[model samples]
Target chain A: MDINRLERVSDFQWKILPQGKMQVPAIIFASENLIKEMDDKVYEQVTNVAMLPGIVNASYAMPDAHWGYGFPIGGVAAFDPQQGGVISAGGVGFDISCGVRTLHTGLKPEQVIEVQDELANMLYYKIPAGVGSTGLINLNNHEMNEMLTGGARWAVEQGYGLFKDLERIEEQGCIEGAEPDQVSDHAKKRQKHEMGTLGSGNHYLEVQRVVEIFDHEIAQTFGIKLNDIKVSIHCGSRGLGHQIGTEFLKKMLVNAKEYGINLPDRELACAPIHSNLGKNYLGAMRAAINCALANREIVTHLTREAFEQIFPGIELKLLYDVSHNICKPEQHLINGVSQELYVHRKGATRAYGPGHPSLPQDFQNSGQPVLIGGTMDTASYILAGTRESMQLAYGSACHGAGRCMSRRQATRQWQGNKLIQELAHQGIQIRSPSPRGVAEEAPGAYKDVSTVVEAADQAGLARMVAKLEPMICIKG
Target chain B: MPQPRWEHFEHQADIGIRGYGTDPATAFEQAALALTGIVTGLELVKDSEMTEITCEETELELLFVDWLNALIYQMAIKKMLFSRFKINISNGILTALAWGENVDITRHQPAVEIKGATYTELGVFQTENEWVAQCVVDV
Candidate 1:
């Protein structure tokens, strides 16, 4: 809590010196105002993350930093395997690959205004939302395994999407090394019926209209024409990812102890990169990542279906899909040399610069598209990864306007029914089974995403592309 | 008090849920229901089958976590969709038997997945008039 010891390098960057058991210093990127509002525990969580083995550089917290399970939700850190880097479930959070994916509706605002209600209703009916919602695809063990391995590619093969759309997705819609066998049957079961359904609690499908274009040429290239309608889907691997993180963390705790790993925070429980537990977890986690990609892909398919019903000839092309959770192997220039490090982005997203090999050819000049979801009633922004992100935060940026208050606190503070009505009055149609869900996700409960995105852009992590405002939202 | 509706707690990474009843048997059933809500959305399992599972841990806290975790583990590992669970915990021990069946993909009825329970702010104690066990699951 005594963050006074932190050294401020600039208006948005601060560093916590290594002390006690800390293996590395903790770096935080936030405007002075945002830092002032942050919970004292963010400092503790980031420092705890610093103590974990194989941590490279400084443990960095985004402007949206807040206290969370093991790693702060807005925390980003990297570990080197040869240096004994480890993977922690707390680092991934409960919702694995829980990030935002954007789809471009070729229509301008005028096109949607006339049939907005019908479009919203059609989307609401086509895409299942709310707690316990299920999608059209029901797969058995073999099929689920294939989906786990294939991800969006599988969905496309099933005619759920156009193959060209895959190029715009992160990892081309799949993270390799997915082992379905490593994924528990419970995870498959949980995913079987839940495919394509938007699970509730902060998860949402938003139809937005681009209000501002920051970089004209880049925005145009990314198809972010002003007043264009873009649908943003925010969710993740759901129960499957949750299961993987849960099972692995328990095993990792034991593994950590057996390996004589000393953790500053038990929530930062982890396992050595080369260990069986670590390998299995990574495999299963990747499978869950695939599940999430496929889930979003299927959801996009449903969205397109709904849109087609409303506007027969329009095309809803994918803008980009990015995951904020989970760890990945990436090449980064550290200390003047390039090395492969495992980057664990808990509530962080990978913001690869313009020339990364992993990026699609079209985006090579634009950098990867980073989608940040705002509250249902606020504005979401699309940003481009920057070279500064590579130098500052290991190619990581904020995921969204992170929660400032707990769901319980939000529920106690507001009434969901009223919140929904207010949103309706604001020209946003909301759909969910529980009013409590609405209250729990009230915009007031989170930091303004535009502010967070602005901080990120200023801090040299990413560059703004466009700002999107929601017109309709499907919440689970 | 309307059977207390639902009792909830956020134990760091895990969220705990408890449903109450006049009797312990109903309390146990409701507790399972509450646990189901914690990991995955309960509504996903529209139809379930009779399946049983048992697990033991050193402490009741661990027992409870492991108990719920076992059910979730089965759900993930077996692809089974269970709706009923019978649990008994006493003397630093826990015995949980869960019921759910294999999901029929043709039916497209999906179940949510809760990975495991965490010890973060875990509790299972009796209040003056009623028994209470609260814990969080890392879902």
Candidate 2:
């Protein structure tokens, strides 16, 4: 992240030219000040990703880049399987397919403000969260495989939601080639009781209201009217995903050398795309993605049920659901030739531009809606993917305001109870099982989300559509 | 016998868990203590029940991760928080017992749920008189 080492391409775009073992340059979409604030490890990790075989263009970092295990958080990389490309487990992180899903409730902020406290309490009690939190739906062996293979479709089949909701979800609810047999019994066992539950650490459900509109046309297309109430759930495949990552990372670590991979960091454990290990990982990872899709669908159902109980005659429609942490096969034009590439986006959200074939027909004109969730105390945003961004950062953008300080530092600086009182004074109702978790995730512990978005917009990673302010947040 | 001790080290994201003792078994026990502390203070957990655990791995470092993950699995499946841990490593197999209670939400104000131990910064080795078990955990 050192400015001297990077050549500024524009005000927001910077390039670290290839050096040492790097096979390609590394690009960062951020302002100089933000780059300075970034941990130096970001530079090291991003460059290391460039060294991976068959990487295309560069290992790019979104505006919110920060140091992570193998690839920096917000890192984006694409690899060509035909060119001996590889798949990395660390690049996907432990929380497989961790993403955000926004639900639009046909109600205004004024309608919910009067009963904010009641709603918050109700959601807190209804939603299973924190460590050892179990959900109402328990999955036996048959249901486990079904959920893994069927994804959101499975949830809908179980009467969790309506069929119309599937269109807005990624992969139309399930990705094919999810070999459940590739997923271990240990992983399946851990997920048996975790379906429909929100795991702890940065996962939350926020009740937000559209506060400002940046692009009226796009905002309308995304079903946003000024002051309209919305609920966003941020989570992923819980225990099952974690167990898969754990099992695969260990396997890849022990076999990296066998694949002729000269690991700059052992945490970047990987195998060649054609290798049996890589195929197995893809099968399991795809299943995990389906698991996350199903988990979010069930949680959305729970949210709808809670809303119906509190305020009848309400409709909650899906706005968009996109994963920030995942690796999926994609087609991108490289050197004026369209080629199949495996795109890995860890801590980065995919922002499909307008007219992209992958986008749903409703969003083809306005582009995909990239939902960004900030801390409970700050404003999040809804951004539209642009054609420029698809080419700029591989159709990816920052997921959230990346953490600026360590959790330990945040806990030491602020008391949780006091932080809650302060947020309450600002009119953001907070409900969490652990006050200590609140302190660790204090808004001040993160970079300014507004600044992060501005950098993304200026760099053409994604275009801003609207801003949202939190009214109620259920944290676990 | 040396007293078991555990402390935290700062990672950019997540947290580093470290345990020190005069022997490997004590270090493993203390490392488990640090893992529990990440969720909530170990002092808050009562020694109400004991759970037995056993795991095997060829590598010592892997064995360390296996041990912690086993405890994590037990914590999730049983809905308990453990404070006191006893570990014995013999014949490349680790057998342990953890004592605690079903979590009292009012008492154990856990900050974050530990997902699993990671290979990042993983270490298990003896240095002179002190033995250390250390690794970064994903939360």
Count of clashing pairs, candidate 2? 0
Q: In candidate 2 chain B, what residue range of length 10 has the lowest lDDT sum?
A: B1-10
Strongest candidate by DockQ: 2
Model 1: native contacts recovered, as a fraction: 0.14
Worst 10 residues of 1 chain A by lDDT: A128-137
lDDT of 1 by residue, A254-300 (tens): 56878779866656778888888888888998998999999889888
Candidates in order, TM-scores: namely 0.88, 0.98
Q: What's the CA error at residue B88 for candidate 2, in Å?
A: 2.1
Error of 1 at B9 (Å): 4.6
Cα lDDT, model 2, residue A350: 96
Model 2 TM-score relative to the real fold: 0.98
